[model samples]
Target: MEGSRRRTTAPRARPAATRPTREAGGTAAALPDAGSHGPPRGARSRRGELDGAPAETPRARAAPRRAPARPRDTQPPATDGARAAERPAVPEPQPPADPEAPAVARRPSSRRGGRSTARQPRAPRRSRRERDQLMDVLHALRLRRQETCVSANTVNTVVTRLLRGLGNRESEFEGVEQLNTGSYYEHVKISAPNEFDVMFKLEVPRIQLQEYYDSGAFYLVKFKRIPRGNPFGHFLEGEILSATKMLSKFRKIIKEEVKEIKDIDVTVEEEKPGSPAVTLLIRNPEEISVDIILALESKGSWPESTREGLPIQSWLGTKVRTNLRRDPFYLVPKNAKHGKGFQGQTWRLSFSHTEKYILNNHGTEKKCCESGGVKCCRKACLKLMKYLLERLKQEFQELDAFCSYHVKTAMLHMWTQNPQDSQWEFTNLSFCFDKFLMFFIECLRTEKLDHYFIPKFNLFSRELIDKKSKEFLLKKIEYERNNRFPIFDKF
Candidate 1:
């Protein structure tokens, strides 16, 4: 036991050949012996262990010999070839999943960082021949609708005769000239163009106009100088003119005038509340409905709310914009009866004359879309939008509040944003239409379709249209876009 203790306690002497040597700096350096120890300290073997280590306990032997990770700076520099060889192979992308496979199996793993592959199958694209056939059908439909459009000659003749009859019948309407307005006058009439709007404007000079509400489109008119023999004097309440009384008298006069026309069977429709027009139905060769509006044309400055409105300077140039601003504004005898207690009679302001002028002469270039100039799809786009709205209205009665006016407003805003005539080139019709639709969707999503003339007026009001109806329309439009307009197939 004493001898075994001495053998274990004594420091094992190294042979002379394997002894440590003292360097010139007096530092002793130990030379590694190949046979004495299996390997150097911390040097890993093929099995990833320190060679020649003492037999570990079961616990120590079971545990992994975790190598102290070297700092990145201390790591050996690797060659490109080495890195390439060390890298794990990336698998080739799999082909599109089998159509017959379960949807869950067909979907690519989200862990792979790819877009969702579980989208609804896209409709097969139509062939060129098929597309042409469809276009031919559309053209035929367009022609059929065009046939129903009221002839320009007929419209002018009727308007002239009616104005003459009105002047002769009523002294108040003696000098009131007719200003043709609406989509028919704008040349963007879609579907049946049997509807016509002619404003019988009586220039009310030296009139004090006050806005009835926050909306710039409504106003209350008062006479600054009351004429002694004026027939309108009786319609005035205190200092302000009563739009309701004036409209009532105007409608009575129009009814009497319609009875005088014998050659053409003209019948006056019953008056509608809040409607500004005295509707006349002409049944001659074809049915034509004309709305004769009574308006007090004022040359006064536009309302304060309109200061920031009509941002068309960049699109129509400053000179054109300035001229439009200088044009006379009109207030028609139209009032919205909110409730029984609503007192102040409101007159809706009209910019129809200006709107018609802008539509006819809408080119950034002087001769744009004219006889010799480049043709843009602006008018065609407007017609398509109007047709679409008409069709949509037939399908969804809830969308009745959304009309062509909203589409026109959106188009106006879109034009201002993308001012260049080249942007609306006929060749880029599909792309332009898609962009317009996208903009419309954005407006619907935000629930704020602003009136073009009045930015303050939100056309998409909860009072006017249901919020869910707007969302439903949005989804429908998106589906149409995604599926390449299957709705047009039915059309």
Candidate 2:
């Protein structure tokens, strides 16, 4: 076994190329001779040999010498085709230029589709003193308008009498309650002090409401049981209550009544298509415009779609939200133009009464903003926002589609987020105003502002407001916010 192990462990001879050559000093060199031809067959070159083989011919020896090894930082730029091809194509580094030298403006790059633009520098924000002065001016303007405008008492008396007379003449409208709704009633009226919205709601019992669209705002109402001598019965096409027929009858009655009352100068405006209001121009010392809307007050359960919304639960408390939801909802004679056939006659649901209640009693605490209580800027902020929207609309005719209602809805949503009355302290009016403007800008950017009452209804409907107008309004809002609203300067 020992002899067999010795035979198997014997050392093999090294390749001729790998065998170390003895020099004059008996030093061993593993490399083959550089001047020699290719190594003999069956022999391999040593580790240090070029290409693991000796230079075979004169041409091989004369091959171009390799460039000297250079530090990465000091490497010369590639110039030759072969060197350039071997390396990545990179821009040549230019010498540093004078820092103070004027920049050379190159033509727009073709790669970028020739679009090269720079935004204009925004105007500096107004100083605190300037803003304060502006606020004073705004206040003075409000007072001046109120002073010059038609007397509210006279307007109210005239509208009330007219509505009463119409109700007396038409049994259907009898016992209809008059609700002063809109910006004027909400105490958010700005420039249009004379404009008033009075809704004459007729309570309709045993009515079934079906949504006209996915938006909870509009509905097709059906009378489950038409009461004897029911005034609304004639306006119904089958079981469905026709908004068009009801509004037409209401407008005709208002026109007839306006003619009989000679005491006050009142002229009914030409009816506009899709308008729910019977607009009357009253000249009682001064001209006052009143929009009398016909609404059906329905009591019972609120719509199922509204169950998840009215996030006021957090702000106004669960009890308050429950009470609000329990309140009867009103439906106005507002129809969509895009609605086809009978669907166009659908009435829009209105929570103006709810809104008024919420706005009037907006404080987290009951006495907030009331007499002998801490003053809050909730109404003041709403007024300012409404004024801004009105002024913008007047300035840019393209923004005619935008209304104060959008701003009002935004303010309501803003209140829910910051429910405490302290957040809207009178002292923080400027800050609150700025925050509201920011919210407006955000709504414009996203274009997804939900109706405060009906979350499903998008106040910023694409059909009503086009994309171009929205973009234009966004820029205008930013401009006004950055620069102290130049639009208000005229006032």
Candidate 3:
């Protein structure tokens, strides 16, 4: 009996090699001998122990309940090396739901350990594409600029002949000399060289200027002592020279002279209200508009209003400023739209001569943007701004009040603010253009763009651009900025 009992209680031999196998729930379970068709060792032992034990209590007899094992894909990733090998292969990591999600999701890989968190790929910056497009447009504009040289020559000939004819035919216009002005003379005219401005500068001696009301831009010009048989005496009302009368006679004379140019298809456009120019429409195949301005050349000191203006001392140097101030300023026969009897006689002050000199000699260094010097992108920035305004105005007639002069004024101010030539690098066109746009946007937002020469006179006052139009224009510009300026695509 003792021998039989020993055989029954004896310990069994262990398998040569035992390997762990992952069950359905990824719970490690011991594997049986390869050839054996039996339950695992743990299960057999638990069954034999249960059979020998006394009848258990309800708590002990009842097995603990377990929730079903989750699928391998549903489980959290295993960090343990051994468990990771036993677990089913995991699929490649997936991107977050939102593709346009912020950059937080795309953190760069960690460097401390070889571990890296999943990151979504990011979108490229728009500037690269924007730069490419801008370069292409500028190239096209350059090609078109070459085409305008022919028209410019033809227009110059017609203007020279017209000036000669006017001096010969009219006694009043005998001493008038052409002072070429506007974007054309500055060499910044874009799209087409269809517009031109020529000032008929008449010498006025012993003149006095009184500021017209609070507006420093307009002036009441009078002769200190009336000259006997002065050509301008016929147009004078009292001591004040009547801008309205002078402009009227100037237009009439221009009309009569335009009639004599039978070789060129030229006709005088009727005088526009509050405009100083006697515009001539010349159609030499393509339509060309020429503005003939009558200016009274003044050899006196500049107006008191311009004392603190120009701000070019730092940019053009103190000597340059002194020289520029020494030069004579001119007054044009430009009447205010809202001017009454006294105001109607007032002439607006002009700095076209000064503007031309500044533009021609524009540079921090003497030879900036010159043939042998560092070529800056100041003119390119100005041209782009002008083109932007032109394109915007064409699409919306509401922006007609906005003009190239505003752009020029803004650019001149920018030069003063960013005096360094490095700020306007030609190769950095996109960056420079964006800076200009942002500055312009800020001016529009504040509604406080001051006239370059007359700081007291706000060009963007409520009288000039109403609140609603300014807001609408602001939105359009912002939209263009955010969307990579689709309007420039037209170029």
lDDT of 3: 0.66
lDDT of predicted model 1: 0.61
Write one digit per residue (lDDT tens) for candidate 1, span 1-491: 01101111112232222322211111121111111122111111212111112332323222223322332112123233344344444322222322211111111122211111224333222223333433443464453444554455566666788788877764677778978889887978755557788899998768887876566667778888987886778888888888888888888877877677677777889887678899988775677788989988888788676666677776687788788889888888878446543334678777888788888988788888999998876777677666666767788877866778888887777666555675566544544455466567656765777666676767776755779988877766656655666666676
**Pairs of residues at least 3 apart in sequence or in different chains that clash in candidate 3:** none
Tell me the tens digit of each residue's lDDT in model 3 across 388-454: 7888888998787788898898787766655656556565566456556655655676677777777
lDDT of 2 by residue, 54-94 (tens): 33232222223343332111222334333434443332222
Model 1 clash pairs?
none
Model 3 Cα RMSD, 1 decimal: 26.4
lDDT of each: 0.61, 0.64, 0.66
Off by over 4 Å in 3: 1-126, 143-146, 339-342
Misplaced by over 4 Å in model 2 are 1-126, 143-150, 227-229, 339-343
The C-alpha RMSD of each candidate to the native structure, in angstroms, is 25.8, 27.2, 26.4
Residue 143 miss distance in model 3 (angstroms): 5.9
